[model samples]
Target: MSDQLLQLLFTGLTLGSIYSLIALALVTTFKVTGILNLAQGEFVAIGALLAISLYATGIPMFAAFILAIILVAIMGGCLERAAIHPARRASGLTLIIITLGLSISLRGLALLIWGTDTYSLPAFSQGGPLIIGGAVLNPQSFWILGLAVITLSVLYAFLGLTYAGKAVKAAVINRTAARLVGINPNTISFWAFVGSGALGAAAGIFIAPVTMSTYDMGFMLAIKGFVAAVIGGLNNIGGAVLGGLLLGVLESYSAGLISSGLKDGLAIIILLVVLMVKPHGILGLLGERKI
Candidate 1:
């Protein structure tokens, strides 16, 4: 259709890709530990802020990004070992409260250090937009999309092929049995936390240019991601990605057709509709409903 329509669609897809990455990271942690980790948004914020600060301190950009991911991963592992494992037997409500507490604590910590200022990094590429026929696309958008695809591909390979990945999957299926088979399910849980944190941080780093970074950004982003996960079917990682993309596109189109002010509320409306109709989500077909 028109260039404006194509531009809106592309923008929606790119933003949706960011949401998908965050959702998948949340799913990875949930599958292994059964904790939704509401602190995920904080993890993304922490990664972006830390990496940006590091780069500001004269560290190379690539090195700063790598270190940010690792640091976030470490934080994830530590949180699991210190906060999650201790209350492993607690009721689901208790566990959720604990994660919420962690989210609050992390946000406070970030604000303490970062001083509540908004920040964003320069795009990895400094060149002009790539124009195609009627529409212009940013190279940064491609970078974000490419990273999402690579992350999913690598995650699939880890969960489906490698021995460590298989062990993690087995742990998810049957923790006791996995332990009996010489797989340390607890260790796998820790790894899941690390992986999830790293992925979340990477999303934060890449998308910082598009969205202003604030201590509270994580909480907001996490809420949208939670809706996406619920709509996609929490247990299905693939569905998480699809649901995120769908939500993003819906929001984008709604903004184009309606009002920008209603875009955020529209996500909630879509979530309500999905829950009312299918509560379990698109991938709920797998088995054992937890959504």
Candidate 2:
């Protein structure tokens, strides 16, 4: 491939990694709670902003990052308890509307606290681009890719290996059955939110250095993430990953070959095509409902 193509591929992969994280968050929450959380991106924004704020207050960068993730995870649990738990018996549509309201509220709160200004963070490592095959790649890009791999590996293990993970899977499959076996669906759902929040926050922290962060950035990220989820088959975690990376590459190429404004439109078009042609996504089984 040419240098330009290589550059686009690298950039696209980085963006895809971020989208994958967000998509994972969405999928996890949906599997356990059956609610599409529109406020998921706010967790991203808050994570970045919180880390910056904490770091400015003399906390170490790594500490700030961890604390931000922990704080967002706690907020996720609190949101479930305060807003979602009471309405557990409500319709999915109602829950979605509630989440939409929560999204707006979170954005407004972020605006009040962080204002309209965009903020940047230093990359995890100090370095220039790495040249490979005549293409320049940012050091931070490697960090993103590495973290993505680690996060996905950990998540796969968590969901496939551990007892808690098995319990979560059981709950997603049949809440009543899980409860009959002494599992608390509510607890599983709550922890799913927490995990989703941590994933969002981690995505934010990783991407902020590359994309910058603003109070209003959450909705767009949420939209893109949601698109990724839809394209990947909303219930399939592996499909989400594929969808995100594929979307990112398509978006990158669209921007390079056409206009930046058309990139998003291209994604939507692809989504429509996917839905019409293959609604189950690439890795998703046609009849599989549970994670």
Which candidate has the highest lDDT of all? Answer: 2
Q: Mind sharing the TM-score for model 2?
A: 0.93
Clashing pairs in 2: none
TM-score of each: 0.92, 0.93
The local distance difference test score of model 2 is 0.87
lDDT of 2 by residue, 1-291 (tens): 599899999889989988999998998788778999999999989988998888889989999999999999999889988898889899999999999998899999999999999998888999788999899999999999899999899887987899998888776666678889999878988898888889999989889888878998878788789889988888777767877898888899889877899987887787788788877775555555445
Q: Candidate 1 lDDT, tens digit per residue, 77-162?
A: 89989998889888888988999999999999999999889988888889999887688888888888888788778877988899
Backbone clash total for model 1 is 0
Highest-TM-score candidate? 2
lDDT of 2 at 162: 98
CA lDDT of every candidate: 0.84, 0.87
- lDDT at position 237, candidate 2: 77
